[model samples]
Target chain A: MRRILPWLTPLVLGALFLASGQQEVIIKVMGGAQKPALAVPDFRGGGDAAQHTGVFNETLYTDLDESGLFTMVAKSMFPLAVPQRPEDFRAPLPPPPRRKDAQPQRQGPWLTDWSAPPANASHLAFGYLAVQNEQLVLFGWLFDVTQQDVSNAQLFGKRYFGPLSADGARKVAHEFASDIIVQFGGAPLTASKIYFISDRTGFKEVWSMNPDGSEQKQLTNYRSICTTPAVSADGTRLAFTTYARVNPMIFIHSLETGRRLPFYNQVASMNATPAFTPDGRQVLYASTASGYAQIYIANADGSGVRRLSNVRAIEVEPKVSPKGGEVVFVSGRSGPQQIYKMNLDGANVERLTTGEGEASNPAWHPSGEVIAFAWTRGFEPGNWNLFLMDVASRRVDQLTHGAGRNENPSWAPDGRHLAFSSNRSGSSQIWTMLADGTKLRRLTSQGRNEKPVWGK
Target chain B: MLTKKYVAALLLSFAILFAAGCKKKAPAPPPPPPPPPAEAPAPKPNPPMITLFAAEPGTIERGQSSTLKWAVEGADDITIEPGIGRVSANGSRQVFPSSTTTYTLIARGPGGEARRTATVNVTAPPPPPPPPAPKATFEERLAREVQDAFFDYDKSNIRDDARATLTRNADALKAIFRDFPDRSVSVEGHCDERGSAEYNLGLGDRRATSAKEFLVQLGVPADKLRTISYGKERPQCTESNESCWQRNRRAHFAPGQ
Candidate 1:
């Protein structure tokens, strides 16, 4: 929808009739559902040698990677191989390691000297920028470590940005890196935005910024006590609990439109932290329907809803798959919180992880092959780290070896990595890592980045 | 002869235009109207009033007709909520609340309209009071209920049995959204408990929200529906199978002060 209203161009009064000719007679089709693509016919006017780059590219990638979808290896990490041959477009990736110990390193390494593959990293990603005359071009590729280069280029995406200025350059770069996974990965990437509750500004509105952590825009910049922001499947909407009038209510907000629609509010109980359906048709959340915490669902426009689950346990932190076909939620049903999954219609019940210590905020890897969930280590009581498990093999793999209560794992669109808030460095900063949990890179270095969501 | 007359008329108009163009044009001046109201009566305070009134049903029920009515003092241009669509300048709209759904009204002009939401709970003859409404097996029931909400997703709002259960549940409701002199309630969100655990957790939260809303329209306060999502966090069906997931998709209300 371009959505970016044109702010340029003069309103020449004499040109009123001219502008009228350009005034788009947009027949707003089916509300927010399916908007017809501009239907840009395949006019193969091949992109000139000019590279298109904007200020938001990097900010988008940082946001996307921070979403935990891509295991982004910074341009600094590349072997100077990608950019050197941007014109050729075919460069061989590094060879795969024989084994953790088989590589030409100290054999029989001690258990602690070698933590398992970082977050059980099984994949690697590389991104680079190329400036071709008038435009800027960014390139990224993901490879399966085990299959080596045998893995097809999972990501060969690029973003063509508009004009750029000195100040907008950095933002545009990050937007590119963040969006590569979305365009090429074919899923929602959450890293491009920020969700923060700033009581520091005297108001507790939810504020978001570009992934470069710039362009700080305030979603609710009021004293309304807004917290726990849950981004919808597409990243255009935010579902969070707020105490606007002293009563806490769950609000569905349009980030682009700044329209706040209130539902299930003014109740004796409070509704907060909504997880939207995969199709963005409904929102799943917890409420005190029978007086105890139970799960519920409702349409995206907020109508025709019903209950799907009932239990006496305190359940929360639900992450829905992109298909809206299944759901995984946190439940203290067994004395401690555990993760569970079920159908979209709330059927075919099954428990995936159990006996683990307080497993909360489970994120589905973009490929849907594995799930990355925040869990407390078995031996360590307070140390929380992100864990991954194969959906089919039922094998659990740990991602974080460092302590610091890394929580709220949000998956990126590519399903190769995730982003989470780690206090490891003394403050809350958003960090990204490979799905296997290797190559950890800190993205957000300032002001409490919590609840990271990959945006589309 | 006609050509000469036309030419003469054209020449006369041309001459008039030439004379008008030659005349001196004055620079716009500020000799305008009344001095800015010396005191601006403090923007008369906003008054509270029914900004909308009308029936939800555009037509009448077998015995009932939907009526939407609203009024906002000191204003023109009033409208009833679209019985199902858009309303015009009137405090009245038509609807059949019990037999049809889509009952939501809003009156707008200058002041914001007060909101009133109600789904039509049309009875094919006041269903036999649910005849004990014996609790169906958890899985069978959850599937049925989920299927109910699913229809509205394709078309309209709650209908038939879904409305029956909602209405019964509504009958036992109280204000859930009041803050003070009020206590908070927590709703456990759940899904059909199928497919991937991650998927179901999200489904449950949505299912939970669906039930909470029906409760609200039944009279519970907006403040009372404390909702949290359990994307398939826990399940009543401990057994791992399709039957179990079916039982899991539901919003279980645990009412507390």
Candidate 2:
């Protein structure tokens, strides 16, 4: 069952829209995880760009489907007549034709065709595109077919402009989807990027891509082994480990300046697994300066370093909690590598995993209420699957089953999706899945890819 | 000839018979001289051969032992001085000596005596192994060992059994350093395929450093050692089992460039 809160006073919505200027009105589905089934018909356009039109339609559908916030109705089930504007919406759908074998016909009201039988869709997203002076102009609208009045059923009206090309159509589609998703109480995924280590260039360097695996670009060209990419929350500075100087050390690359910023060199020990604090002012990593790998935190520029762990065990993969007051890291102090949590000051150390199995690569959810990590679970050699643990209840859930090695899980900014690396498809590739282990999508197929960290 | 001449005449026969009697008397005189000089000789007994007399192991370290073996024939008594006494004609004895010493065995028989000596050279104990070289830096510790350090699955810290192996490796490195004082060893860290390629590189580095630190604590010079991590790229075994993974997760040693 789904509940729509469109009854929120216009005064409040006006205040919100006035403050953010991002959306006209919010349409939230309250109660359980039930998502409103939405039908997105093809966009009618007056351009010689059938391919661009197809690209826009497919991109829009995929963006909404992958958002995990809606149940997309297939185009095959859509009504023969599609609404390209609010005026095209018709109320009081006509009755089905009286025949032994009847089919959905264009004679019925578009809303009735969508809100009733086969489509059974509660929402409809329709749009129109036109090429004006080599520019693609898109007019998009979302409607609640449950409403009879056209004005009451219409959700919002938006326009997007891009080059009259497939890529431009895809960009416009992304923007339109972002606008619709914002109304459904979900952050726009278009702004989020995933940073990962890719060896496609003959060396493992930091590479990044859009959340939907588009617009992939190499961020680091260090012709040496680089790994454990941690992008700052603001998406400006990227911290990672590289052996560019023959020693594994922390390197802070400026995504803004496109240059490697200065980082303090500890000289003589490997520094790895650098994570930026939520505020992006400091970094947390594991270093071997104390004769053993220990968790350490330093300023963003690698100054004013302070040790956070002193145990004589292997401690690495330090990830600062999203809340900024704690850290989750992998440590061998308990004989087997286990996820451990501690205060930012290195106090109150607590092991999070219990019983048998070795766990590593702890990634905190955006809400800081749970963590995702890779664990062996006593399955024996080469089977490290991903798992999630609720920070409050200590209840653990296996996010990934045995399908080769799955590790390096990074949570999306929305806290409902994850990006990780797995060899399930052969040759360790970057993959993304919903937080519930659904909708697993492979993001990279060129060479070996691993340690995908999703950045806001 | 006198007898023949005497026979020529019967009347001269009495003279010939008197000449033959004179010749027979001369012979009788010689027999009488032999009879006066008859005497007996005394008998002699065999001497001791002293066939075998020596220590089974001629040299030994302090607190160690050797065996003394001896064999003699035709001897009534056989005695070994400097710790051993009367012994059987053929027997052996274990000897424990604090210092180098020689044992002498004398065999006495009716005819004569024979003597043989055996020495058990006890070596002095080695000076207590010097404590870890205090001057060696931490980085050098990672590069000096001649043995690979093994780790548990996904772990980089040294294991208990690996400690013993590293101890022996440290001693081997010390011996090697003595012969090639200018040579260096590279501590190459590796990992099994069980870990992410990125994390495993860090883990491999930790394993190598752990072994290096242990070797340094065992007195191997840190300056003669350098460390490198191959992560899971250089797997010693490719099989997907604990044995294979254990083979892969090791801090192997190699001659430094």
Candidate 3:
């Protein structure tokens, strides 16, 4: 086996290059409790394409590394030999069964063994890039190197064609990483955007950026305080609260036309935190139209308003479940603020959080099995931290430590990550983290960003 | 004739006697006039006297100005109630009252004290039926009548102080509804900067709703009041202290459409 190593490397590398261009290839391998180590090698391309390929490869590595589910193996530990083509190497089949009673089985060739000890990487991802007609053509492939069957070892492969630009490289990389994540039975979050409030322009306004904190752009310029932004499922409309008038009123902004229309124009009354129902046909918000802050539901256009909660206590920060069966909100009906869930019609209200301290800003996860909210211990003096509660079990897990005040937890479409605002960096800004409070990354650094809502 | 001759001598005597008696009766007519009474000593005058107190143009419309003029004799200090403090012993002040008001003037001195009152009858045109009371606009109500009810940190239940404020607010709302039957009241809930905006909104909402509910129980029509949670968005104080946060975590009342 040691003598065959030099020849085996080239053959395996060649096979990966040949397999890269194929579209929609999927393979699976047995997984374990520990994070699988992954190897991301540089793509095979030359000239201007080489630079683009480097960018793509680096981005893919970063994405996977930031996911907190994979351990990247460095290239320095790779084998000395390199294969440039598919014909340069070939794998050997396993030996036949020794017992005569054993049925004859088909055997598939496996790639060179790199899944053990020092360079123990269970999977490998590599691809090729080409510049053709001023367009970038990218080929990406993921292999389960731990698998013995070569045919089954190919996890996934995808080809992307886009403009030959840096942004194009990022797009291709993100798409490929999304494919890889999906192959691992995890939801892909790369395509989503985050909507949050920023005071960068001297006034708090609604703004949005990619999940990776790229392409940040202001969405509303009311020149006043705009906050609590909620994006529609289709990403065409944004619902937010603005103080352009005497009182804070809900407004719906059309992303396509860049026009904003007042959703609730009742003078001297507050209407805020407009969350769209799963179907986007209705909106659930906190309104003082009844002379108290209670959950109210209205048509998406702000018509046909009706009060939803009648607890006579303060009910606000309402979020409709993804399934549209119930609404979770922060209520003070039982004394200190606590998260409560009620049916769409406000029936069968049940408290979701208890014990010392206050719980608020309840956001139902898209998966509909858990809720994320902000909690602070009753006797604590610092800021609120994030917490997740299983809806069924009522078990709670703290997501953020007391690293500045972390609150306003909004779940990404994938349900595995959340975007929240924290003042840990000296000022309140938007930050993202995994569901279990890992992989904390800052998303905004400018003036007092907050109330981040992840877009679908 | 012989009898008359004989009687003449007697008559002459009788006539002489009657003339004498008539002469004596004339002197008795001047009987003594009534005697003059004895002279009495002069009495002493009282001191610290508010000799004159008057309100010029006493009959004026509501909110119209009236001048309270007063004159005091031998007084060290003079003051009036319902807002005016110590003033000159003899002075006048321009006053504006929303309704008919009676101003009392008190003058104090070594000799003693004196009191006088001048009534300014606010004489606006006859109010319409149902006794058209002075109606306060929404803004005016918010500034004048509606009280801000505050709460403890992280708590939304009405505090004792908050209850006092809500009681006054409820009374004001009742009067407002009486005068402007169609108008409604809105309670705005607010929070301090200590908590998250999302959570604060809920907290503020609870505060506002708690206040409104108290008002309802106090006879402010439930339908006449509404509630909104501004959360921490509209803070009354920006400082990072308990005082500021206490002010921020309050329910402010205002007139609504």
Candidate 4:
């Protein structure tokens, strides 16, 4: 069982990483059931590179901490001999046979200091940052400190180079952190983005920011009401509803080209809440073309428009399943808005939510096994909170307590996290948290923000 | 006869001599020219003359104000009607009119009395209809007589009061359909701020449908009615209270395109 245990941890981790559908990796690890305790020491080497190293160390620490897959050892508990390279990592000498009247020796800390006591870390990540040849040079290493064989303790080594600036340091740090995470059989969170609507500039425009809320940038300057931003599966395009014209219409913009794409404006008083299919070949949205709001599917370029819901009720916020054949949407056919699942051709039409209050804004996890949505369940009364429902069993779980209106849950690409908007902080703003409803971090503070959609 | 002939010849000679003498008197001076035609009596002093008498804005929307301007000359008293009793000879007055009205300016003086009329054309009535008037249009009547059906929080079922309201709406709609069979009315559902914006759209839709179905059961033509949901986007009230929320949750009617 001990032999199997050592291999089982890596196998399970690799399986989870594969199940997440992240970029394929060739590395693996052998460990136990407990979360691998990791210690990230401030990188050595400082001069003109002090500020850059500070940025790198801070960003690296945040990335690893937010991953939720590691137990970070506190800095105060770190050993004195923080390694900067493979040569710096050394094996401790055996203690003297019989220490008679011999004072305890004062020596550099060894792996025992890290593997024992308050710094009980199973793994260690340390690196060096320096300005070399007018560039920021970084060397990062991850070691399994619990390994008895000193040579086997080293897991991997990597080197990265960038411009000698804070942004460059951040880039290097993220890259190194991604490598360390991939080595541990997990998806990296540094590259994923959250798209949302913000009225900070006096107009609701499409804005995007890193999941950590850094580098918030406006993508559309329509000078009109814009909302419900959805990014394509490949993250190359964005679709949203804009009131640039007299009536609301769906507009698709190419994120790669920074230009608007052609979309046929449906002949309706309102066309809103657009979503993209997993294949990025078709777009789904709700339009009032037939005098009522119904789900409509069209080509990505807005051609071949076809209605997917035939009921004489409001069917809106149509989100296609990540597997690409089914769609879950909010409908009023049963009197109040409830989440329903249906086939691509508008058949099957199975209701997924029931009981008091309304369910809305259903978002599919990349795995397609669960959906995250907002529901005003009876217990909470008029307050809206996010919930997760298993697609097959219909088992429901509430993710957020009734604090203020918390809604618009969008699953991150890793499927373990979500980005949503909440008024818990006194005003509507974009916030992100783990899928299990922990580590809530506010993403936007300027003006009101809502309808966050995470992707890539 | 001979004596008579001699005497007649002498007389003829005298007569010829007198004719010759008359011709010689010539042009005894042409009689004095007739006196120049007499001048007509001097004109009376300038009577009440209105050089400019007008409403600065001849047309205005209901409840809007417009100014009545006038410039009068040669009159001791200048008065305007239809609200303004009297005014200076040259002055302007801002007038707030409830409906279209014509103001007449009467200038009276020693010379004469002059009158001028300026009409202010008022447009459509304000949104809130005053007590029903005889001239109200079918559209206006429908807006006035039809009461919006209200709903409870997060519920779309017809409430007791909403049932009564829908019944009256059904009757009004039936009348409208009878008069204008081609016209259609839209039932716009609205919700309060107690719900998510997206879900409220569906909740509002259900409310509108509830109202529409009730009207259909009440014998109102289902074809003449359509439904739409504004959700919480178009709230009737913004205050955060039960009264304001109740006011916001309703199935409103609008004339269809």
Best by lDDT: 4
TM-score of each: 0.44, 0.70, 0.65, 0.67
DockQ of each: 0.02, 0.19, 0.23, 0.17
- Encode model 4's per-residue lDDT on A146-179: one tens digit a residue: 9876588888888899888999999999999889
Name model 4 segments beyond 4 Å from true.
A1-33, A97-107, A290-292, B1-189, B202-229, B234-239, B251-257
Give me the overall lDDT of model 4.
0.83
- Candidate 1 has an lDDT of 0.53
Give the higher-DockQ candidate: 1 or 2: 2
lDDT tens per residue, model 2, B1-257: 99876667776767777887765443333344345655767768788988888886899999988999989998999999887788899999999989999899999999799888888999998888999767653235435545577888766668888998999999988877876787888888998886655456667877787888898999999998788777886688788777988889898988776
DockQ of 3: 0.23
Name the runs in model 3 displaced over 4 angstroms.
Answer: A1-36, A68-71, A74-77, A82-110, A147-152, A156-158, A261-268, A378-382, B1-151, B154-189, B202-229, B236-240, B250-257
Fnat of every candidate, listed in order:
0.02, 0.27, 0.44, 0.29
lDDT score at residue A432, model 1, on the 0-100 scale: 68
Task: Go through the candidates in order and give the clash count of each.
Answer: 183, 4, 11, 0
Ranking by DockQ: 3, 2, 4, 1
- Model 1: per-residue Cα lDDT at residue A251: 83
Q: Model 3 chain A, poorest ten-residue lDDT window?
A: A21-30
Chain A TM-score for model 4, please?
A: 0.87
Q: Taking candidate 2, what TM-score does its chain B reach relative to the real chain B?
A: 0.44
